[model samples]
Target: MENQRGKGLSFARRIYRPRIIGLGIGAISVFATLYPLDLPNWTWALLVFNGLVWPHLAYQLSTRSAFPYQAERRNLLYDSLMGGFWTATMQFNPLPAVTILSMMAMNNVAAGGLRLFIRGSLSQFAGVLLSWALFGASFNTQITALQIYACLPMLTLYPLAVGIVCYRLAIKLSEHKRALSALSRTDSLTGLLNHGSWKDLLHIKFHKCQQRQMEASIALIDIDHFKAINDTYGHIIGDTVLRHLSSELRRNLRHDDLAGRYGGDEFCVILPRMSQSQALDVMERLRQIFSQYRHPQVPELKVSLSIGLAAFSPDFQDPSSWLNAADKALYLAKNGGRNQTANNAGKSHFEQTQMA
Candidate 1:
């Protein structure tokens, strides 16, 4: 409901300036047609109010109403009705009458689409009937040079204003689309790539390695006994530990490296242009740094990581094979003991940074 109201308020603001410009210029066109008719003093006064004062009045009515969008639609209907009244008052002078009615139709269509356009047309017809009953109907087929000149400004300027508003709306919609796309690709908890996005990138990386024979490695990291940490401390502290690991990964990895949360209690990384030994050294450093992390709220809490490394090999059949190798290494690291790094090359090392 709040969002709908906000959109309504925005609609009111967007219509405000265009109404002012249209009515102000339209008054000039009406004045040109009425000048030769010798209309009564009250008729001239009403014209002045419609052309000069009504725009501001309409804006106030729409903006201050509880249902601003509905109020603005009512205001548009009023504009169309007034347009018909003036057209009849001018005895249906061709150029100014067409200009007034056509512009009001355009406004109704732009603001509320086809439904409002149909309603506004009915309002205009009612206005025409009322004007004819009051002052009688007459037609003025001949148009003066001055009247044509007066209608020119409305014909050109009003459409230009509407176009500018539409262009700005398109730009805002495009920006919102991009922001939504980014949110879809990112992990909510850690701001890393989500599992699906990470796997997509992995396939791309695998193809590049196959084609160029590039040196690269993939790692699977498990928080040692993460379920135990959550069971003892709560999910909040478990989340904190996960964020800490992700922060350390961002700090240690190269700019081109890709990292993602691989699901509960596990993270994955792709290290391009690095060999198996280099990947191992990087993982070992990360393990050491992370083991030192202490939760501020829970001073006694400590964390450790078990990381597995797998370098790209020509023998691998596909991206899944490469990922499976890293998974196997992770299994070995967990079995050898927690707080260690293991490689698919059949080597494992234990680092007693924190005692269980």
Candidate 2:
């Protein structure tokens, strides 16, 4: 309920400024038309209330309602009705009547598209009939010079207010789109790139290497005995360990490097422009540092990494072949011992002695 109220309040505020600008200018036009004829004291008072007080009241009505959007739509219909009442009361004066009706129609369309525009027209017809019954259906065809000048402010400023509202809405929509795109690409647990996005990046990187004949490598890293850790320390601590590892990877890797969670207990990295030997050194260092990571929550628990490195090869027909080589090397590293770095250069496997 609180969240709904907040949204209501926000919606009210977004509509408030435009309503003020539009109605304030409209009030001037209506007052000019009303001033020429001698209307009753209560009628003038009603005009004042509509122009000066109604905008704020309508905003409050919408914000305080259970469904703000619906309340605001009703308010817009009320605005259209008022426009009609004033038009009829002015005796259909050419300038003010047209100006008022056009502005109200614009507001209706902006508020709820064609459907609300038609609904507002019906309300306006009702107001016209009410005015005819009350005031005996008068007509004043003449549009005095003062009234034309009065109508100018509504013609100019109301459109500007509507434009500003539309621009602000566009900006908010763009921001939402960007935020959603980032969320889709990111891993929920570790905040790394998820498996599919990482794979997409790997494909791009493979193409880049093939085109430029540049040296690059990919590493598949696994947390050794991760299931045992989760079973012993609980999944919560295991999650903490994963988060810590991702943090370390973020801290240690270069800005250009890409790291991703390639599913449970395994992460992937792309090392561009690095030779096989350089990739080995980097992976070895990462393994050493990760093996030394001590969780604050469980200080006695020790964590280690088993990583597999595979340099890019022209013999590979596709990105998956390159990835498969890294996966095989990762298997070897896991099989050799719990903590080590194993390398696969072309078809040959290196000894799993790269350990700290």
lDDT of each: 0.91, 0.88
Clashing pairs in 1: none
Instruction: Summarize candidate 2's per-residue lDDT along 65-163 as a digit string, tens digits.
Output: 888877888888888888889889999999889888988898788777899999999999888988888887999998888998999999999999998
Give TM-scores for every candidate, taking all chains together and pairing residue i with residue i. Answer: 0.90, 0.93
- Candidate 2 wrong stretches, greater than 4 Å: 1-3, 346-356
RMSD of 1: 3.3
Evaluate model 1: give its lDDT.
0.91
After TM-score superposition, the amount by which residue 307's alpha carbon in candidate 1 deviates from its true location, in angstroms, is: 1.7
| Model 1 agreement with the true structure over 46-105: per-residue lDDT tens digits | 988988899899888988888889998898888888888999988999899999999999
lDDT (C-alpha) at residue 281 in model 2 = 83
